[model samples]
Every structure is written in structure tokens, then in C-alpha cells.
Target: MGKWLLPESLADILPAEARRIEELRRLLLDLYRTYGYELVMPPLVEYLDSLLSASGGDMDLHTFKLVDQMSGRSLGIRADMTPQVTRIDAHLLNRAGTTRLCYCGSVLHTLPRGLWATREPLQIGAELYGHAGPEADIEVLQLALESVRRAGVADYRIDLSHLDVVRALLETDPAAAARADEIFNLLREKDVPGLAALGPDLAPATTQALQVLPTLYGDLDVLEKARAVLPALPRISQALDMLAALAKALPGVDIGIDLADVRSFNYHTGVVFAVYCGGWPNAVVRGGRYDDVGRVFGRARPATGFSLDLRELAGLLAPATASSAVRAPWGLEPDLAQAVRALRAAGQIVVQILPGHEHDQQEFVCDRELVLRNGAWRVEPLASAEPAARPSPSTAI
Candidate 1:
């Protein structure tokens, strides 16, 4: 392979794409701020113990580790920012009441999650700490929905599940982990024949319940059907109740319930949920209630949150039709230089032409041009292939 060739699943984000990501980042952080989620930026790398403290084995497998030259301790690049934020809540903030925290950054994964997945995911998320009630989970769910809405991505659905349901079933057969793994994989794959092949070793009732789980999806009626189909194990019953309540709370979103779905089950002790876009194979956002995540940090706070890949979300959203850019000739006069600086300060994307090179009209579609007009540097319209604005190009220019 060529030296410049990027590793598989790792690619560069060019300027046009990067602006969209940055715009979404700022918008989401502002949204989280409205909900009182103070921003915290954890480092990209940390000691292995801290990174892996609350995260489960799956995360460990994804994280990249290196020996720190100075400390000689194992350091790992974060594969997810949630655990790091949890540590912040438990150790640094140490607040007794509710703490709303949000973060946005890239996480390095050892492998791509899916065929088109990126190994370096630009993770943006919000975490609610010190609150374990269904209300907190509901609030986070609402936030997740709004995040996608704000990005202008439509036809998205949220699949809600409580791991406790599976835990309740699994508790019946602790020693049958091998059999349980087979069942879980079968359920994930939605392979009824595979599950049927392995059901004999499990209790007949458990087998029946597992069979119904793969089919337990769709609208609110799925929960109703689940009540009739699955056993009335206490924890499972409670989880179903919670899912029913969530369904009621989130009527606006196209919601589905997956009683058998257990993504991040070991890491998330309570409810686990994923948000999927229509026609997209993978869930764009995943989160759930993990109340015990902070315990290892010596302050077990109730925490629930969701994270979305910004790059993936940008892909889902409508392309940014209008971006900012103003062109100017090579600066010489003090007035021209001052005008360019002022334009930049005023938040206009100003591209000044260098002496040897002219501005690439295709790359930097200078919608507006800085020119000397009426003895003053003023913004003038440029004749372009596309109309920069409504009512045609300005006649004055």
C-alpha cells in the first residue's frame, strides 16, 4: 500500500464535510447546555484502569493500548467517551444532586463496527448523573430525539429495551452461559431455526420465552403482545412496565421495543436503547441507564445518556446547501487588511488570494467579494454559477 493510503475504515474528513460536523457539534452542545448539561472534555488517552473501569469487555476489545513511556503503565485510547464522563461525574464534580454533563470528541476503535463504519468515531453525547428514576431516562430519550431532529434527519426510530428482562431470564440458568450465548447470538441474528436447534438444553419455558423475544418488535402493541407471550418473571415484568411507560412517554417518535435485544448488556445494568435511521443498517445512536458505572470511581451515581457519531449523523442529514465564504484580492492597503480582519472577526469565512495562486472558484465558492466601493471596503456580490441568494445577483455589484 502507498504511504499516503489511509488504513481501512480510517479516512480524512475534508473541509466541506468537516464544517457540517463542526456545525452539528456546536448546535448539540448548545442544546445540552439548555438542559443544564455542563460541558467537560476528557483527554483522548488515559490510564487503562480508568478507561476500562465502568466499560465492559466489548469496549476493552475495541480500545487501543500503549505503554506510557514515563509512567510505564498501560494507556488506552478511548473507544467511547461515556466512561470518561462518568469518571468526571463521580470523582471531579462529586455533586450530590443531579449533574448534567455533555461531551463531543473522537474515539479510536480497534476495528470498524460495521462494513461502512469508521474506526475513529466523532462521538457526541450527554450524560445525566445522580438520577436513576425513569424520568431521567425519559429526559435523555427526549434529548436524543431532539438531537436528531435538530440535525434535520428524518425517518429515525428508537428501539428501547431493558437488559433486566434478559437478566431475569438468564438468572434462571447461571451455569448455562454457553447455551445462553448461543441463544443471545441467535436472537441477535433473528435466526429462528438456529434458536430452535439449541432450545432443547434450556428449560422448556425459557425456550418458549426466547422464541417469542426475537419476534417482540414493532409498535406499542408489541409490548402488549410481550405481556401475553413472555413469562411473568418479576424483573421481566418490571422491565416491561418500564418499556410500556417509555412507549407512552415517546409517542411522537416511531418507537419499537426489543425485549431480547441486549447491546452493551454487561456495561449497562439497566435499560439499553438504540436509535436507527430508516434505510440505515446500523443504529446511529446508542445509550441506556447504567447506574453503577460510577461505583468503581468510588461514587456510584445514577447515570443515563446517549451518544451519536457526528460523522454518521452529518451523512444522514441534508447536505449543507449554504456555507460561508468571501473572497478578497491580495492585501496591500491598510484599509483592505483591516476590512479582511473585521470580516473574519464578524464570522465571515474570508479567503484572501495569495500572490502566486488565485482562489479556486469551485472549492471556495466566494458568494460575496470584498471590494473597494464608494471609497470604503464593502462586501459585494459575485457573479457565480449558482445564485448566492434570492432576488438574483445584486445590481449594485
Candidate 2:
């Protein structure tokens, strides 16, 4: 095997893609900041129990576990950052009022989440803690849509689901409740046959509701259908009302409802959502209310946030163009050095060409050049043809 070869689902991000990812990261962090979200960077690895405390079984299966060398406790490479951020809010900061936190980092998954996905994803997201109202969910959801919008994703919609709806139906029958995990898997797959197979053990109403849930997807009309068909459980009605309220909150945006979307059943408690774009078969962003998550950290606060793999989101957009740069000659002369420093300080990408590498291709497109004219460096546009050729160090005045 080639020494440079990475594992099956892991690959290196090349220069172009890396630049795009970095740019998007900065843009998102800035967006979060404007909303008063303070940035927090949790370690890439932590004690297993604490790391998986709020993530549930799905995250547990994806996390890479190892024994700590010094402490001898089991440690895990985090597969998600939400729980870590939760711990920070619950234990570290312990702020009495609202705490808005955002994070961006790498998370290792045991396998690729999709056919073309990478095992190691650069996850970026924002979480809001200490508020349980629909307003918090509304704020987070709007920010999520704005994230992709600012990233240049024009065609996208948000699919909203509330876990409480499913939980309520299951609670009506002990047998259905006992087989909650299996039923959730079936619902996510939209496996009507499998759901029907469980009908013998489940109550007639529960069985009917479970089967009908899969078909209860599409636009706002699905909510009306749900009310008429599903059992008249208060929690179910409340969950449906919440979904309608969220859809109403975002009037211009495309919205969807999927009652059967229980993929995150174990993790979220209410109003779960996923943002989907045209080309990607998977959700680009996933988040929802997880009030119970903080409880595990000894501070049961209302928490809701969303995260997206920057790499995945970047893939959906057109490749970024090479940034325009200023070509400068490599030199130790005080004037030349000072000129280069000035351009750099002014937020320009100044590429200094070495003597031997004058004809080598550069990652940046040098649209302008720093030339010495009349004993002082001056900025001038390069000849149309000059930009294509490697910058010449000998051209230094």
C-alpha cells in the first residue's frame, strides 16, 4: 500500500478547497458573532462518558474510542461538538442568563455518513442555551438558513420535524414504547412494511399512527392531515402547533414537514430540523431543541442549535476563484521590504517570487505588481499577458 494513502473514507483537502473552506469558516464565525454568539473551541478528544452524554447512541457508534495514556480513562475522538459545548455552558461558564455559543472544528466518524462523504468532517455550528421558547428555535433556524444563503447556496429548503409527536404516540402503548428504537429506524427509512409488521404487538391506534406518520410529509398541509389522522394526544397537537409556528415565522423561505423523520429521535426533544439543498441527498444542516442534554451535565437548560460540515456545504457551491494578489520581488532592501509589508498590512495578498522560482506557477493570480519607479515602489496593473506567466524576480527595480 502507498504510504501516502489515507483510510478509505478519509482524504486531504487540496489548496483550492481548503481556501474555500477557510473563507466560509470565517464568514460563518463572523455571522455568529453579530448575533452575540461567543466562540468556543472544545478539544478534539475528551473523556468518553462526558463527550457522549448528550449525543445519544448514534454519536456513540461514530466516535473513535481509546484508553487515555496518563489518566487511564476511556477517551473518545469527538464525533460531534454540541455536547462538549453543552458541558461548557452547564459547568464551565454557568451563566445565569442566555449563553449563545458557536464552534468550528474537526470531528472523526467511524464511517462515512454518505456514499461520497468523508469520515473526518469540519463541523461548524452555533448553539443557544438558557431559552426554551419557540423564539430561540426561530432565531437558530433563521441563522442556519442565513449561513447557507451567505455561503452562496441559492436553492435550499428546511425540513422540520418534532420528536415529541412520535414520543407521544409511542407512549400510548407500552409495547410500542418498548420497541421505540426499532420503530424509529423504520420510520427514518419510511419502511411501511416493517412498521406494519409491528402492528400485531402495537395497539390499533398506535399501529395506525405509526403507519400514517411515514406518509405525513410535504408542505404545511401535512400538519392538517396529521391532526385529523393521528391520535388526539396533547403532546402530538403541541408538537404540530410548534412546527406550524416555525413555518409561519419564516414566511419567505421554503419549508417542509416530515413527522416520520425520527433519525435524531434519541438526541432531540422537540422541533428538529434539517436544511437540504438541491444536489445533496443528505441534509446540509441539522439542529433542534435538546433541553434534556444539559441535564446530563447537571444544568438542565433549554438548548437549541444547528451544525453543518463546512466541507460538505462547500462542495455544494461553485469552486472559489483564485484570489487576486500583488506580485513583489524577493529582497532584503529596506524600501522593497517596507513596500511589501505595507501592502500586506493593507489586507493585500503579496506574493514574493524567488529567483529560481520566477517561472513557477503560483496559487494566487497576481493581477498587480509592485514596481520601483523613480526610487520609490509604486502599484501598477500587470500587462494582460504578464499575469499568465510566472512573476520574474529579475524585474525588481
Candidate 3:
């Protein structure tokens, strides 16, 4: 025995699950295509050096490393796809001014705690590189909203945050930079008590501003509350003003302004946001700008992108109806096999029971079964198939 082996946190997307995911991917691709985003696929693995060039802080820890046998250089399983997409724009596509791309695939990331994270995750998303204004941001946001709607999802909230706000506040106090790392983690985890304990008596106004962040999630009113406490920080004020403009443009969409929400990855340079539905512990879609990330690849093209875990999103949507499930036949006469395949090709589910295994019909759950009668193909419901009969004893035979 090979020890009944499998990696602890890894999993295979079985036929049924893969089909469901593919359906979702097709719908999203169609919606994106309608909006002018061409589809692209980057490599699953990349040279370690190129991969690390823009992997921002939190992302660096999740990448899986290995050594390439032929090249003798380090290689890594991509933990995220945005870095690779940026590489494509800077090196291959090299679109002179602007380019829009959408992609769907699996990414690998190792988690220290094997239980909470998977080594492989399916990702589907879009990226808009070269454009840096809020208009581009709005387009991507609208695409995300439309994609989810196309996927049959409703009732979700978007958490909007400004990376510039947090960076501005920290830059003011030189000492704050040293504690920047700790502050980043605290804000992401929403550890209000931890943030309070680190206090060396921050400016009264700064203190008030920080306090508003934890509860800043929800509608546009959060901006007003933040403005009252945000201190003399001009960058913070400008960021808030931009957010206010977005709020005005996107009325009726649930939006929240979280001043304390920090970017998990250093590559995110400006506005950052995430989309979450009720009952999901984590956000389904997340994206932000990274003006400096492109420079890592030796080009400074401004960029922003977001991706969803297709597998997780499928879980939220109802699984395909039983009748729609795909199943291959056990075996069939050559002609019958061709006919069954043709039916399947036309969107009808087909299953063929093998000779001598005809009694095994109960083992296969399908809406319709294909069989041969009078030298022709016949289709019948699962309930009509006869259950396999038990073998007769030698004496009876």
C-alpha cells in the first residue's frame, strides 16, 4: 500500500465539483467579455526571482518553493496571480497605454495551520493595468458587481478602505514606522484592544480617528464620522474625499469606509476593497491599486485587480441540479456508445451500463440511462433500470 497518501491540505476538484466551477467560470468570462475584458492564462509556475518581485508582505509567506531540475534555479507555485498578470503586461502584451484582462485557474499556497487553509485554490478574476484613476476603479467595481449578479448571487456588502489613509498616519510619526508592521496586523484582525494597548498617548485627534475605524464599516455615514476625527493629515482627508465621490456615484450599493482597514499586501498603494456575502467568513472578492508594484518588474505602470475563489463561490451557489450532473458510461456497444456521446454533446445527461454489469444500475445515479434494444439506442429513466440480480449458485446453474 502507498500509505493511502495525500497532502494534508490539498484536494482534487472531482468531476461534479469541477463541472460546477467551470459553469461559473464560463458565466463570468461571458460577462467580462461583454464589457471588453479579453481572457488570458498565465503559467501555473514561475521562476522564484520573478515570482517574488512583487509578492507584497503577507503574500510572501504563502508561496510554495521548489528547485527546478533542468534549470537548476529556484521555482515556486504561485500563491497569487496578479504578479504574474503584471509580468505579462510588462513583458509580453506590453500594451502601450492600457489593457484589460480576465483569467481563471488554480493557485497554490501553503498554510502553517493545515486546517484553515488549502494548498490549492481555484481563482477567477479580472485585472486592469495602466489606468490609475478612480474611473478605472469604478469600472472594475461595476464588473465585480455584475459578475456576481450574473452568477446568481444577491445580498452582499462591499468593504471599501484606503491604504493611503493608514500609510499617511503612520508616516507622520517616525516611531510609528517601526511599529508599522504590528499596526498592520492589528488592523486586519480588527484587534481593537491590541491597538489600544500599544498607545503611547497618540494625539487626541489621531486617537479619536483610530477609534472610529473599528466601527467604520456600513454605509456612507462612516465618512462623516471619520472626518470629525481625522486630524490635520491632508492625505487622509484627500483619500476620504475620493471615497465620498465614489459613494455619491454609486448610490444604493452597500458601501463602507474603513479608515483602519489596512492592505494585507504592501503592493496595494491606494484604495483597497473587498466583497463579502452574509455567512461567508472571508471576502469572496478583493482588489486594490499598486502603483509601485509594476516598478518591481522594472516598469511603473499603475495597476489594480481582483479575483474570486471559484470553488468557494460555487459552494455559496446551489450545486447543479442532479439531472445536470455529468457521468461517463461503464461500457456500451460501439454504435450505442456513439449515440450516447452525441446525446451528451447536446446537453442531455447519458450513462451506459456495461454488459454483465447491467444489474449495477443502482450504483449509478443519473436522470437518464442509455441502452440498446432491437439494435438501436433507447433512453429511459433511472427508476426503470432493473437492479442487478445476485449470482446463482453452481447447483442452480
Candidate 4:
């Protein structure tokens, strides 16, 4: 491979896409600030023990570990930013009431999630700490939806699930408890034959429940079908009720229920969801509640939030409208320099055409120019200049 060849599933985010991601980051961070989510930035690497303590269970496989020469203890590059932010919320802030926190940064995954996925993802998300009700869940859900909407993703959809439902069903049987891993895999794959293979050893009722999980997915009405089919256990019922409440809150919104949609992050204790956009084969965003993630840090708070790949979201957004530019001849004259600075400060894209250049200044789409017609620097529009095929000056940065 060439020296510049990037590893599979890892590529450079070029100028156009990088600018799009940066702009979206600013917009979403501002949105989070409005909701009282104070911004936080956790270190990219930390001691393996503190970094992975509780979440280390779910994150071990995805983390890249190395020995710290200074302490001789292992260190890990974070694969997920959630646990780090959780630690900060629990130990550093230690606020008594609810804490709203948000973060945006890059995380290094040991491997790509799928063939189409990136190993290094720009993860941006929000978390609500110290609140333990469906109310917080609803808030996070709304924020996640708004993120997609603001990105101009059309016809987006959401699929919601409660891990408690599956946990409730499994806790009922000793046999199911022993074979929990196998049962979980079978249900997730919706493998009826594999589940039936365990019928002789597993209870008939538990086997039946596991068999029905994969099919218990679809529109909101699927909840009705689930109520009729699944055992009328309190935990299961409670999970269903929460889903129903969300559906009611957002009428006509495309919401779905998938009882078997378990997340890889096992620390999550309650509701979980994945958001999708039109024509995408996989989810564009994902998150859920992980109340116990803070236990290792000595404070366990109810936390729910969603994270999306800024690069992916940027790719999904519609092309942004181009801004007109003012082409100015480069000079150190006080008036001209002041005009250039003023234009830029007032939010206009000003492209300064430099002096002593060996090349022609045909790069920018020069709609207007800073001219000195009346002794003072003045603004003038070009009479017959053709627009240049280039990215807006802002994006080029």
C-alpha cells in the first residue's frame, strides 16, 4: 500500500466535509447550551482502570490498550465518550440536583462497527444526570429528533425499546438464566429453529417468549400485539407503558417498538433507541439510559442521551447555500485594511487577492470588489465577472 493509504474504514475528512461537521457541531452545542447542558471535554486517553471500570465490561473489545511508561499501568484510548462524561458528572461536578451535560469529540474504536462504518468517529451527544423517570427519556428523545431535523434529514424514523422487558422475561427461569447469552443471541437473530432446539432443556413458556421477541417489532400498534402475547409481568407492562407515552407525546411521528433490539452496551438499565433517516440502511444515531454507569465513580445517576457520527450527519445534510464573496486587492493601507476587517467582522466572506503573487487570482467567485474610486476604499460590484467554481471561503478553511 502507498504511504498515504489509510487503514480500512478510516479516511480523512476533507475540507468540504470537515467544515460541514464543524458547523453542525457548533449548532448542536449551542442547542444543548439552551437546554442547560453545560459543555464538557474529557481526556482522549486515561488509565485503563478508571476509563473502563464499569463500562470497561462492554467496551473492552473495542478499546485499544497500551502500557503507560510513567506509571507502568495500562491506558486505553476511549471507544465511547459516554462513560468518561458520566465519570465527570458523578465525581467532578457531584451536583445534588439534576445535571445536564453535553460533549463532542473523537473516539478511537479498535475496529469498525461494519464495513461501511469508520473506526475513528466524531461522537457528539448529551446526557441528563440525577433524574430517573420517563420524563428525562422523553427530553433526550426530543433532542435526538431535533438533531436530525436540524441537519435537514427528511422522513427520519425512530425505534424505541426497553431492556427491562427482556431482563424481566429472563429472570423468571433458572434454565434461562444459565443460557442467557445463547438465548439473547437467538432472539436478536430471530432464529426460531435455534430457539426450538433448546425446547427440551428450556421451559416451554420461556422458549415461546424468546421465539416471539424478534417478531414483536413494527409500528406503535405492535405494543397492543405485545400486550396480548407476552406475559403480563409488571416490568414488561411498565416498559410498554413508557413506549406508549412517547408515542402519544409525538403524534404522527414515525416511532417503532422492537422488544428484541438489545444494545451492545450492557450497562444500560432502561429505555434505548435508534434513529434512522430516509434511504439509510443503518441507524444514523443511537443512545439509551445507563443509570449504573456512574457507580464506579461513587455516584449513580439516571442518565439518557443520544450520539451521532458528525461525519455521517454532515454527509446526510443537504448542500448548504453558497455565500457571495467580496474580492479585495491586498494592501497595508489603513482604510483598505480596516474595511476588510470590518466586512469579515460583520459576517461577510472577504477574499483578499494578495500582491506579488506568481499566479492569477481567479479562485474566488468575485461578486464584488473593494475599490478606491473616490480616494477612500469603496465597495463595487463587478459588471461582467463569471462566478468561480469553488467552495465558499468559509468551507475552504
Candidate 5:
């Protein structure tokens, strides 16, 4: 028989990294819980229709599809948690006004062969449903910032954008659908010349907006210039106004707006944002507003949320330091029973060496390993459970 192997872009987390990541996950979940966002575990897979309910744009292409034998219905591995959460808010929560929900889970996606994109990604995030004002957006943004801070990510920047602005400007013109798509693609790539080649069928006013598009990034000042040229575009103006408000609220935080950003999920009809830090191309956190996601599942509710890619965040993690080590008490063979009970009483992560697994002692993954040698007891350091310790395990009576 041929050897079995993991698929591309997928691999095991192993003990060392898995434990570390679990700690980070716990820290984030606790933070979310304290904010009154109850945690919910969405399924790893769902009916294809359920998964696709709120997802749009290139999302459909990235999802992994399969046929479920039990139900004989199409199923898809969840590509994102937002859609599933939206369904819950609509059909389950049934809140007339608002609901705050949190989730931590793994998501799967298909990607180009040889790409670094993990087929499996861990997501930790929260969703706020049924709020419509810019205040809701501000709340979501604040939570995102707090999540990063709790995770110890101090160096990062928030890149903000408004989907309604771009869409409103394009929909007002008479350009063909294909032409509009082409122009968007070009703008995404920052190809000003290709955008110009779309030919100036665009009205002079719209053309001027197009020209300024390349420079539509920076502080609140850009918002002023945009309004002067597209004064009648209320959708764009409203979104810019919200950005101005958000900037004022987020004092000392690095904030900027990108009007040309169109990569937001298909459901997002308002402000969209991504959080980035130096040395990484992937956004650690992504979120947006989806007012109609509830309507798709037979319930009408507004929703907004943001999720952080745990895998990407893990990539930027720094190694352990000496001050972070964990220690456990040593036990003698005569005191084995007492030591085990004492450790257990002290709320320590105690693992007794069950019979026949003596050889497995070398593989234990606790903060400290207790062994009964001769009449004395020994304590062994579990490097994975804590930071670096003496290379040797200790012995005592």
C-alpha cells in the first residue's frame, strides 16, 4: 500500500506549538467572554446552501465542496465563521434588536498548490448583530483593537474602507458590467494606466473621481477632497463621515482609509476593515457590516463581526523567554499518593503515569513530570508546557 500523507497546505500542530496556540486561544476567548459576548461553537461543515447564505464575491471559489452521504446533499467546509454566525443570529437568537456572539473554531479552504495558505485555519472572533448606526461599527472596531491588545500584539495598523462608496460611484455610471469589473480589478492592482485605458466614457465628474481614486488613501483630509468632487454621492459621503467619526474615537491608533478596497465579503454593504502589522501580508483580523445577512435565512437582522486568523497570528509569535517557566513540586515514591493529591488540590495540571505507559514518560507534555524513583520522587521539566528550564529533570525524597 502507498504511504498516507497530509494534503497540501495542511499539517499537524504537534505538541509544542499546539499548547502555545491553545494558551493564546484561551486568553482571547476569556477576553471575549468578559465583554458579554457568549461563545458558540459552529459546526466545521454545513449544508452548502447554509454556508453560502451570506458569503459572496470570490468566497464561493475558495470553499471546498463535497457530497454528504447521509443526507445526499451538497456540503461545504466552512470558509469563514461570519456566515454561519449570521444564520444563528437570524434563526436562533431571534433577537428583535441586537445579539453579541463569539466563536472559536477551525475553517478549511482550497488554495493554489504550493501556496502558503493553510487548508485548515483557526479563527477566534465575535459578531454583533442587529445594530445599524455608525456606533455599532465603532463598537466592533474597538473590540477588534482590544482583542489584539489582549493577545500582546502592540505593533499594528488598521486599514479601513467603505464598500458602499466604491459601489455607489461605479453603479451611477453607464459602464458595462464587464468594464466595471475590469476597472475594479485594475484599481485593486493599483494600475492607474489600465484604469485610464478603460476609456473616458465615465462623465467628467466621475472621471475626476477615478483620477483621484489612486490617491484616495490617507488621513481624514482625503474624505474632504472626495466630497468636493462627488457631492451628490450620499452613500460615499455617509461612509466617509463614519470614518471621520471612527478616527476621532480611536485616539493615538494608526488609522487610514482605502476607498478602492473591494475585497470585502459579498454581504458587506458598509464599512470594512483589515488589521495588519509589519512583516505580514495577510490581515490578522478582518470584519465588516452586513445588514441583510439575516434576511437570507428567513429572519431579518443587522450584523457585523471580525475574526482573527490564529495561524497567521501564530506565525508572528516570538519564542519563549526564561522568566515564563512553570515549576512543580517533587515527590518521593513513599509520598507519591500525597504529592499527586496535593498537586491536584492546588489546581495544577497533574498527570499520573498510568501503568504500561512508563516509556511514555519521555513524551509527557505537562509543566512538570512527577516520577517515583527508588524511595525518592523526581520532578522533570516539561519544556513544552512552560518556557526553557534546566535541561535535566530533578529528583527528591
Candidate 6:
């Protein structure tokens, strides 16, 4: 085995991709700031129980656990940042009113989510705490859409669902409720035959409802079909209404409904959403309302937010063009140093050509040069076909 080889699902990000990821990170953090979202950076690892407080079983399976060297308590490498941010809101801050928090960091998954996915995802997102209304959901959803748009994804759609829709139907039958985990898995997989197999154990109405769920996906019209076919449970109606409200709130954006897509059924408590772009088979962004996720921290609050893997999102966009830079000769002279410092201070990418590396290909495209002209340093455009091995100036510093 090669010493440089990483694990099966993990790989290093190269210079170009890393630069793109960093730019996107700064842009998104700035976007969140404008919306009054304060940035919070939770540790990459924490005590297992606290870390998984609100994330539920799905995150538990993905988290990498180890025994703490000092505390001797089990610690986990976070697979998600939401719960940590939730804990911060609940315990650390303990504010009486709204708290808008955003975070960007690495999360380690036990395995790759898909064939072409990275196990270590650079997760970035914003969360709104202390609001339980549809307004917060709408706000976060809009921010999510804006995030992809700003990232240069022209065509994308958001698929919305409410866990309570499934929860409502399952509550009608104890058998169905008991097998909730199994049913959720089946629904996520859209396994109609598996759902049918459970019919003998569940009520006839529950069986019918479970089977129809996979098909209840499309535009807003799916909600109408749901009302027509599913049982007339009040909770189900309320869930459907909430979905309608979300769709109504965002008029111009492309929205979708998927009652059967219970990917994070256990983690999310209310209206959940996943954003999809054309190039990626998986949802680029996922989030929703998880009211009372902070309960485990002794302060349950209504919270909603969304996160996306910057690495994956960066992959969807076109490669970033090389940044233009100013080429300067390497010298310790005061004038040369001052000139370079001035350009750097003015927000320019200045690449100093080393004594022996003048002809070496660089990541940056040096469009301008700092040449000593008339006994003073001056900035001028480099000739397009400048010779790689051009002779140095006779009056070299």
C-alpha cells in the first residue's frame, strides 16, 4: 500500500478546488452575516451524547466514536454541525429571544454517502433558533436557494416534505407506529413491494397510505392528491397545509413535494426540504424544522436551518479561472519590498519570481509585472509573448 494513499472514501482537495471552496465559504458566511446570522465554530469533536443530542440515530451511525483520553467519556468526531450549534443555542448562549447562528467546518462520515461522495464533507450552513413559525422556515429556505444561486447553479429545485405526514398516518395504528423505523427506510427507498409486505401487520388504511406515499411526489398538486386519498387525520391536514404555505411563500422558485422521501425522518420534526441541482444525483442541501432539538440540552427551542457540503457544491460549478497576478522579481531591496507590499495591500495577487524559478509554470496567470523603470519601480503589463528566459535588467538590485 502506498503511504500517501488515503482511505477508500477520503481524498485530498487540490489547490484549485481548495481555492474555490474557500471563496464560496467566504461568500456564504458573508451572506449569512447580512441576514444577522452570527458565526459559530463548534469543535470538530465533542462528547458523543451532547454531539448527537438532536441528530438522532442517522447521525449516530455516521459519527466516528472514541474514548476521551482525559475525561474518559466517549467522544465522537461530528458527522453534523446542526446539533452542536443547537447545543450552543440551548446551553451556552441561553438567550431569551431569537438567535441566528451559522457555521462552516469539516464533518467525518463513517462511509461515503454515494459512489462519488467524500466521507469528510466541508459542511457549511445557517440555523435560526427561537422561531417556530412558517416565516423562519421560509427565511432559511430562501437563504438556501440564494446560496446555490450565488454558487452559480442556474437550475435547481427544492423538494419539501413533512415528517408529521408519515407520523400522523402511523399514529393511527399501533402496529405501524411500532415498525416506524422499518417503514421509514422502505419509504426512503420507495420500495412499494416492501411496504405491501407490511400490510398484513398494519391496518388496511395504514397499509394503503404507506403504499401511496411513494407516488405522492411532484409539484404542489401532490398535496391535493394526498388530501383526496390519505386518511382525514387533522395532523396530516396540518402538515399538508404547512407545505402549501411554504410553496406559497416562495413564488418564483421551483419547488417540489415528496411525502415518501423520509431520508432524515427521525432527525427532522417538521417540514423538511432537500435542494437538488441538475448535475448531482443527490440533494445538494438538506434541512428543516427540528423544534425542541435543544430539549436534551435542558432548553428545547424551535430551530430550523440547512447545510451543504462545500466540496460537493464546488464540484457542480465550472472550474474557477486562474486569478490574474502581478509578477515581481525576488529582491531584498527596500524599494522592491515596498512596491510588493503596496500591491499586496491594495488587494492584488503578487507572485515574486525566485532567482531560479522564473520560467516555472505558476498557478496564477501573471498579467502584470513590477519592473524597475527610469530608476523607479513601475507597474506595467507584461508582453503576451514575453520570453521565459529574458535577461535580467543590467541594474539588478
For each candidate in the order shown, give its overall lDDT on alpha carbons. 0.84, 0.91, 0.73, 0.83, 0.74, 0.90
Error of 3 at 348 (Å): 2.9
Instruction: Name every residue pair that clashes in candidate 5.
Output: 130-302, 331-377, 332-377
Candidate 3 on 35-72: residue-level lDDT in tens?
78888898999998888888665666788899999999
Native-referenced Cα lDDT, model 3: 0.73
Which residue pairs come into collision in candidate 2?
none
Q: How accurate is candidate 5 locally (lDDT)?
A: 0.74
Residue 388, model 3: Cα distance from true site in angstroms? 24
Model 1 misplaced stretches (Cα beyond 4 Å): 174-182, 322-324, 388-397
Cα-based lDDT at residue 91, candidate 3: 79
Q: Candidate 2, which ten residues in sequence have the lowest lDDT sum?
A: 388-397
TM-score of 2: 0.96
**Model 1 lDDT tens row, 34-111:** 998899999999999999988866588899999999999999999999999999999999988999999999999999
TM-score against native, each model: 0.92, 0.96, 0.84, 0.93, 0.84, 0.96
**CA-only RMSD, every prediction:** 2.5, 2.8, 6.4, 3.6, 4.6, 3.4
Q: Between prediction 1 and prediction 4, which has the larger lDDT?
A: 1
Residue 334 in model 2: lDDT: 97
* lDDT per residue (tens digit) for residues 1-397 in model 6: 9899989889898888999999999999999999999999999999998887677767878889999999999999999999999999999999999999999999999988875889999999999999999999999999999999999999899999999989998888999999999999999999999999998899999999999999999999999999999999999999999999999989998999999978877678998999999988888999999899899999989999999999999999999777777788999999999888888888878899989998888668777788998888877777762444232232222
Model 3, residue 44: C-alpha shift (Å): 1.9
lDDT of 2 at 307: 97
Please write out the lDDT profile of model 2 over residues 1-397, one tens digit for every residue: 9899988989899999999999999999999999999999999989999998788766878889999999999999999999999999999999999999999999999988886888999999999999999999999999999999999999999999999999998888999999999999999999999999998899999988899999999999999999999999999999989999999999999999999888777888898999999999989999999886888889899999999999999999997777778878899999999989888988878999999987678678887788889898977777753445444343332
